[model samples]
Target: MTESKKARSPRKILIFVVAMLLLSGSLRLGSVGIAIASSPEDTEPSTEDGATLECVTDAETQELMALLRERSDRVAEVEATQAQRQKDLVQAEAELLENLNKLEDAETRLAATIQRVDGASSDDVSRLTSVYESMKPKDAALLFEQMNPEFAAGFLAEMSPSAAAGILSGLTAEKAYAISVVLAGRNANAPKI
Candidate 1:
């Protein structure tokens, strides 16, 4: 029984050592196998849609480059449009300012012409009023009869009240009434505001 126990113990120790050596060797071989499998030279030819990995990578790179170029061109075109629009806006602003300046100049000249016309007409009215004042009322009424109704009304408006009254009294009733109506309605168009 002692010899049997001694033989079993040695056998168990040898088997354990052998199993440990086998496990270490297998682990080493597995790591080597993984390394070889991962290497480009030892790896299987991997394909997608019948194209190699390198070819797929190159195609993807080319598509990305084309997309980037298209985007870049679009950006450039947008920038150019913006630049042109800015230039057009500046020109339009300048033209508007120039037109405004021209308008102001025209308005100023028109105002001066109106002032001259007003001054001359008023001077003519004053001279005519004096001429009418110097004449007999009956003679002035004759001239007023020959005058346009609106024109005579304007002369009467500039005259003194007593002179206007004398002229109105001398005029025919129908003519006097029309002139009076024109004077009355002159301020009818005034704005309430």
Candidate 2:
């Protein structure tokens, strides 16, 4: 109504409008904060829209991975040891086979030598005697002792009886007696010349 009252009235209305705006702004801010607090935190990005998400730390996962790595290393070490042992076994088997071959070869040679030596003829005996005559009487006696009794007796029959007697005389009494005994037996255990 009055000029001063009109001016004061306009000021009060402005104050009221400002208060209402501030209250509305505060309510909007409060609602936004409550919505943010109530919402769930983002886990891992979803592979499917409805998929449940779980989270784990890097160090804990890495420790489990390290444990798996250690187990793999142990398995590798055991495999290596087994492989080495298998290789050693193969080597040992090869060595055994090689030794067996060498032994078989040696036995073959020995059998051949024995066959040649034991299967001598009368002419062979004469040649052997001639060779023996050049040797020491003791050595000759040893050869005669080792000879088959029948062959030695036949060879003795072929020799000059005097030479044969001399060689017999030269032998030790024990050997001479053994020869006489063998000669006397009709079933003497000796091979034919």
Candidate 3:
């Protein structure tokens, strides 16, 4: 019984030592795996010669970079186009303002010319009226007889009441009636207020 116990102790001792060696070896392997996973150098793939090679960018990364560059280019293009449009708008506005100023100057000149013409025409009408007034009523009536009733009425309106009466007296009844009608109706459309 003593010999059997001694033999069993030696076997158990050997098995324990083997089990402890296996556990320690497995623990060392696990710690080495963790160290390799944490290190940046060990994360990269090595060539057949054991030399770590530089990683080429993946297709997705390259595509993303290209997209970003394209977007940047588009943004720059849009900004440039907007700037050109703004500049064109400013130029157009300036041209319109200049044209407006020129138009205003032309209008001023036209108004002055119109005023001069109107003054000259008014003076001519007054001179003609004076000339007719100085002539014999019979001669003036002859001239008025050939004139349109409305035109004669216009001249009569500019004359003194006595001068108009003298011209009307010299005119034929029908002609005088037509002239009188024109003169009377001229103010018909005027506001009474």
Clashes of each: 0, 0, 0
Residue 86's lDDT in candidate 3: 100
In order, candidate lDDTs are: 0.90, 0.78, 0.93
lDDT tens readout by residue for model 1, 73-186: 999999999999999999999999999999999999999999999999889889989999888888999899888888898988888888888988998999999999988888
User: What's each prediction's TM-score?
Assistant: 0.66, 0.37, 0.70
**Better candidate by lDDT, 2 or 3:** 3
- Which tens-of-lDDT digit does each residue in 84-191 have in candidate 3? 999999999999999999999999999999999999999998889888888888899999999999999988999888898898999999999999999999999999
Q: Give the C-alpha miss distance for residue 189 in model 3, angstroms.
A: 1.0
lDDT of 2 by residue, 1-193 (tens): 8999999998999999999999999999999999878877774445577786666689989998999999999999999999999999999999999999999999999998888777765458778767766666666667677776666666555566566776677676776777767667845566878
Candidate 2: lDDT over CA atoms? 0.78
Query: Which residue pairs show backbone clashes in model 2?
Result: none
- Residues forming the 10-long window of minimal summed lDDT in candidate 1: 46-55
- The most accurate candidate by lDDT is 3
Instruction: Tell me which residue pairs clash in candidate 3.
Output: none
For TM-score, the strongest prediction is 3
lDDT at 165 for candidate 3? 87
